[model samples]
Target: MNNHKKEKGDVMVEKGKLVKISYDGYVNEKLFDTTNEELAKKEGIYNPRMIYGPVTIVVGEEMLLPGLDEALLEMEVGEERELVLPPEKAFGKRDPSKVRVVPIKEFQKFNIRPVVGMPVNIDGNVGKVVSINSGRVLVDFNHEFAGKEVKYRLKLEEVVEEPEEIVKELVKMYIPSINTDDLKIKMTKKTVTINLPEVCSFMNNIQTIKMAIANEVIKRLGVDKVSFVETFEKKKEDN
Candidate 1:
């Protein structure tokens, strides 16, 4: 088989192909820098560490770090590339004002211990504690990786073209539940719909999660629209 043919879903391992990759990442540049290569090496990222996994991304999918995805589009099977992404292309710069002091009692409601220099998740927001005073605690909500340029050294390992494979990727990316038999998938030319079972109660706020998941899948699958439906009991119907 000619590996370069441009067929609809022909699996161009070149780009827009669903592939599994192993990659190592490093962060360096003017915006962000480690103490040194020695320190980075000690942190297990200076040397190429394996990060193998499957990803269903179209050649131009914005699903990946923009720069890394662009670089991968120019690669072939088993090809490797080292991509340097700027702050804007990476996680973006840190805002100093994101660090603020809040009453220690606010965190106590979540049963979290407010300690100086400890990391905590506040209402789904991850922040690190900078200081703890008598009643107030300083927390920085900026991402730890913010204000950093990142380098991704990646190699495409395999490309798969089967519809089932595509479906599996879609399921994994969205539901992430290993027991996929409970989830239902339906697709049309312009839109794909995912149906969740009643047993998945954690999906009560599925609308928000669904939109986020659909956004990622649509970008990779090259679909224009997607929607999700949950199979939960309706309060009105119950009455």
Candidate 2:
């Protein structure tokens, strides 16, 4: 189940359904991000600390970029294609007014040394210092990829529909740190139960987390009541 195998059906992606997708994004033919490590390594941007796998998202949730979100509405499971997005559709065009020059003395007064390409926040605005000259620093507040075209190689892996599977997907979205294998989910006619392992239940502010999960489950899954089950092991007594 770890792999996003193509399901045999004619289901088209729509809003509020749990969706799993694998995609690779590129700018000017250079790989920037991908869900597969082998593809990432092949594209020369692999990071050891990165997690590589299909990402599950609810369509129309705005979890992805604007262009990708719009594209998801027309996608079918197991379909693969390449899409090119213009700057406006992607991250929006860069604004020249967002670029500003500041006096170097202003940074020096705060014990800060401004360097080209260093990130800086000035007057509550965040930007990268793209240049430094005599007595002045130039900052560009536009997004790094602004004005650039992007390409995405996308694959729709699965369209989750079953009640238990949908609950698991929602849990994965809410508590991603918990391993999927460790989650125990059950669905009945009017109720759904989630059993959180000891490792996940005892973390900081667990009651709040459980509350949020319950709310999401009831609101999204239409279950009348949601319950949480926590288990603790007793110490063995030698007879």
Candidate 3:
């Protein structure tokens, strides 16, 4: 895992390839994010809303942080590497201009009481309140990790090439609750037809999700169209 040596006949990662990766990201030697569930729990960063596992990313697509995304191009399947990224590659340097003072009445207008260390959204920009005094609230709009170096231990798990599996992975990425086995994927020429599971029919934001899935498939896989078929069955009641 320490030495990244690719032998002959190894499948090298390339742009536009769908690859799965597991990584642990650290800032100031403290684990900030990880793909391992147990490690996340151990580090007290486990979130119930997060799905802990290897995530698929399209190479060179900027889906990942810039540093990590560039590193993947030089790796092969099963290769592991540890790299430290500068602030620019991580979250970018902190900007003093991003810090602004707003009148406390702005918060009161929205029924909000501004408090130190509280996050707030103003004019669609997310910022954290650093201080509140004299009827003025200081908000810093820089990212929480701005101006910090980050370290990552990365492992490229698999490079997915099959069209069917690629579509399935994309679907799962958007609708994590949908079982891939329950999805019937049919590819005809340039179109990919997915018969969604029964559970998906009632899921919220399904239409939006379908549109997103279709856009990804077309953008990444060059598919002409994606069709989703949802079917409902009638139950027969007997006396």
Candidate 4:
């Protein structure tokens, strides 16, 4: 369970690897201005929710948040530790300036009518209506979970080194454009080949995308080093 003997400068993870992890964490609900005593008293009411669960991530695939992946890189198999991540490293500090009041007419542009105290989705962003006064509507765009410090109790559970599972996880975690069954993987000593159907033509820059996916998967799954081969038909190329 304890594989903490990771050598310095070794790539902690490689492309197309699968890793399982169990993590539990709490996020402080109050902003920097709020007192710790007050925050503790409001736990579970206004306090940020503490989350714990296990999930498998394919390295270099950007499966989890960037910061969360970074935390896993230094860990070894069955390694468990409590991580105190600051706002900058966590969800980020909430910006008060992001809250603004806009003309009520702007809401209609998106075919949405402003209602007092109702939450509205604005162009993929969600915000609650704080006020409706004299043709103006006030909304706060800051993430509801922003500006809180998060604590994580995490353990690396398992790491899979096979290429086929890695490729399967890659398609599951990053390339949702392709069906898992339709995606193909072939591995040799020197290269890992990936084949996607014509339907997944959007993944044209497979090399670069695979690199990014590998980076994320490594952080989440904990492995190192991989080369990829992606092939698609000539006529189905995306313009």
Candidate 5:
């Protein structure tokens, strides 16, 4: 695609393109989530841990909900739309079977004191405790917003085109602490090589991050392989 010559707002977004967008998600007209910091604050749902701003997503990669992914492909850069998604496309209908009663002994075994509305993980599945009565704990395993219709107001900010920019965006998404400008990325016809910073060598999850980065780049960029090179230099003694 000769994306360079196309002016901003004229390019059509397609599958595998990197897209940056700002969105406000609501359920029953009540804001549930938003990329705008001010709106989140105004709605009294501000989360300090969340990095609020326009988010970048790889289109059609299931990075977003199924409904949103479908909507993204039809949008042009700078276009804005509001969409209402049914339960199936949003979070799926809630299942009655997902609500189960567990014996109080199970919680006791884990040294947990079950309380109403407490979130707990059981056998690797996350659930919320609904009620605790007479030696039994009721847990609901459904997603918090399951069975609810959702609304999203989305603005397509930009569609990223260049392979180098794509790699940088991926790296930034994975390693938020690292500066993309400091990264050394080399791309060939069928491969991408990334020289990681020295700090990455000390992170316990660096291997997993490298694997995720490699997987995305190869899958979305159609590269045969992605390699990460980590180098640690020795410091000389003070003269």
Candidate 6:
């Protein structure tokens, strides 16, 4: 009975595991972020320029909010959870000290007419204008999400087990344009080798991508080696 692929109950999310998940994050019943393309489009916040896909999160890596990252340690593949995270664990309570008053002339000097709720960057810190009076503007520099509870709807798609699968997942994530299934793969006890797609030969950062993918596989899957093979075609004249 313990022979087939891991039973649903047998697999539990744990630290250092490579897992893929899709999530929709909300604050105050408004959709602020999501990995679902259809939902993004329906909410009128869709951006065609960005890549949309399941996110690969290394559990316990602090790659997510403190509370959400902790929640991943208790999730199982195929489990969809709706969770609410408090302010301290989410983004921390808002800070009034971060609120500043700036003269309206300052914005006008930069060709900007400051308006309520308008975002502006000052000294590399982004803030939003909350009020305007006479010749002054009130800007709140705290995180837009601070002092609020954040709700997340998350689903773990898969808990990658084998080293080769980890490599494939990494390639799929880092090189979204490549079709990992069609790429040749050969796996040994301690190494996973993959043939690069023909189109990737001209990729600006192919080597970087390879190194990053290999490093992630080693770090997450504990594989010894990952070799990316790049083959060349013989010219007709030589043949």
RMSD of 1: 9.7
lDDT of each candidate versus the true structure: 0.65, 0.83, 0.90, 0.64, 0.88, 0.83
lDDT by residue (tens digit), candidate 1, 1-239: 11243446532346556765545567653223232355456664453442224444555657766776776665566766766778777777899998988888898887778878799877788899999888889999998878887886667666656544565565565555435566678877777777767655565565666667677667656788776676776656655
Give me candidate 1's TM-score against the actual structure.
0.56
Candidate 6 clash total?
0
Rank order (by TM-score, best first): 3, 5, 2, 6, 1, 4
Error of 4 at 139 (Å): 1.4
lDDT of 2: 0.83
**Which regions of candidate 3 fall more than 4 Å away from where they truly are?**
5-10, 219-223, 233-239
lDDT of 1: 0.65
> Candidates sorted by lDDT, descending order?
3, 5, 6, 2, 1, 4
**Model 2 agreement with the true structure over 1-239: per-residue lDDT tens digits:** 12234367745677877789899999999989899999888878999977678888978888887888877777777777688999987878999999999999989889999988999888888899989988889999998889999998888889888778777777777776667788888888889989888777668887887888788788877889999888777879999
Candidate 4 lDDT by residue in tens digits, 116-210: 77887777778788889998999988766678667766677778666577657665556644456876666655445566566555557766777
User: What does the lDDT read for residue 115 in candidate 3?
Assistant: 85
Model 4 scores what on Cα lDDT?
A: 0.64
Per residue, candidate 6 scores C-alpha lDDT tens digits across 10-101 of 65688877799889999999998999999999998798876677877678888789988887777777877888999988988999999999
Score every model by TM-score: 0.56, 0.79, 0.90, 0.55, 0.83, 0.73
Find the 10 residues in a row with the least total lDDT in model 1.
28-37
Error of 2 at 174 (Å): 2.7
Clashes of each: 2, 0, 0, 16, 0, 0
Which candidate number has the best TM-score? 3
For each of the candidates, the C-alpha root-mean-square deviation to the true structure, in angstroms, is: 9.7, 5.1, 2.5, 10.4, 4.9, 5.8
Candidate 2 regions off by >4 Å?
Answer: 1-10, 100-112, 120-126, 133-136, 201-209, 232-239
Which of 1 and 4 is the better model by TM-score? 1
Candidate closer to the true structure by lDDT (higher is better), 2 or 3:
3
In model 3, what lDDT does residue 123 have? Answer: 95
